[model samples]
Target: MATNRSEKTVSVLKIAAFAALTPMLLAGCTSIKDRRGYVMDQALTTAITPGLDNRQSVEGTLGQPSFASQFGDPVYYYVSSTTEQRVFGQPEIEGHEVLKVAFDAAGNVSSVTTAGMDDVRDINPDGDKTPTLGRDRGFLEDLFGNIGAVGAGGMGGGVGGGTNGS
Candidate 1:
């Protein structure tokens, strides 16, 4: 009788522990969603009309842009991205958008264009070293190569051109 009761109690405790931990286990598997940059609003974006809407009006409609072109024709870029990340994984871009509002010399909106995920490009860098047009140097060469070159041309040996005595 004592054995039967202890076994039943142990089984009930096991079931209760599993029930409490089940939700947490499932929650850990869910991907975390994150939104970055300017949040897009359909109505506000639609309100912007080229030629009619100027910089001020567009700013009032869509608020400030994510960035603006510094050179060439003036353009305002409203960029947004939605990413999902697992518990210990890098965030993957699920959605991306870039709204480009170009302006003429008059500062009025000349053209409005929206680019979606199709314009998104994935760039994988080549290892840790940056590729350059120079020669490939080894660890020893990099350390000792500069030894003879620095003071050879009377370049960096002295701090100033003046004599040591004032």
Candidate 2:
């Protein structure tokens, strides 16, 4: 009887242990991770040697950049990021990289730059309202500000005849 009771207690403990750990175990299964944006491989990135690799060579080697600049030498950007989300919460950036390549007028690679999370800057906005060079007024004030500004006077004087009939 004693041995049987001890076995039963052990079984109960095992059940409790597993029950306590079940949530965490199941949570692990729900963790989602995604590798997004420009896929940067070491060998592929190293293959691009500035001054040697032109637009054609670079594109042929690593494909199109994530984006390109609008002006100047037309900088090309390769961005990569890894996001991790648990359950239904917002995804968090686990890794980030910004690779930039500047091309000269001849389309030859002029410079290569790389940035990571370490280079990220935190921006703390001052307030909700955006500051602009204009007078700030309430909604009602704006709605009524131009109400009486324009005169209701119909067209300049007369359009041919008023009292002269000519």
Candidate 3:
């Protein structure tokens, strides 16, 4: 009887342990298809050829773009990302791809090209310089700053105290 009870306890413990770990294990196994559609929409692949598509005919089809630039000449960009996650392991980037399409003055595809991670460059690689609007104020200038003392008697406590007796 004692042995049987011990075995049952062990079985229950195993079940509980598996139940606790199942979610985390499943989380790591999520496939890219689950996130691909949403990511693609957020990246805005369609807007890449906005003005270029004419009313009469289609000049060319440049599949998708990674994202559209907030500033600069109108350009559409497309990007693909792959990530791997494992139990007790940090998610790591497995792969990435980007494509860019630029339109010409007449609103037709001007150029199409691919850009890898290495090709991208930070506009302000170093850092922004702090602006020097003017010279720093001295200690005295800060202490005797803008505020002036209360006028002679504007309030009850001032020199022009109202008729109310103290």
Q: What is the lDDT of residue 57 in candidate 2?
A: 91
Clashes per prediction? 0, 0, 6
Scanning candidate 1 in windows of ten residues, the lowest lDDT window is 157-166
- Tens digit per residue, CA lDDT, model 2, 73-99: 778999999999988689999999999
Model 1 has an lDDT value of 0.92
Sort order, lDDT high to low: 1, 2, 3
lDDT of 3 by residue, 1-166 (tens): 9999999999999999999999988887765422231133323344444455631222234343446667766566666666766655676656555666666656565665665557645465657766668877778987886556544345345643457663
**RMSD, each candidate, Å?**
3.5, 6.6, 8.9
- Higher-scoring candidate on TM-score, 2 or 3: 2
- Residue 38 accuracy (lDDT) in model 1: 95
| Each prediction's TM-score versus the true structure | 0.79, 0.62, 0.39
Off by over 4 Å in 2: 1-29, 142-151, 154-166
Once fitted onto the true fold, the runs of candidate 3 whose alpha carbons sit more than 4 angstroms away are 1-11, 18-98, 122-129, 137-144, 149-166
Instruction: Show where candidate 1 strays beyond 4 Å.
Output: 131-136, 141-166
Scanning candidate 3 in windows of ten residues, the lowest lDDT window is: 33-42
Judged by whole-model lDDT over C-alpha atoms, candidate 2 comes out at 0.88
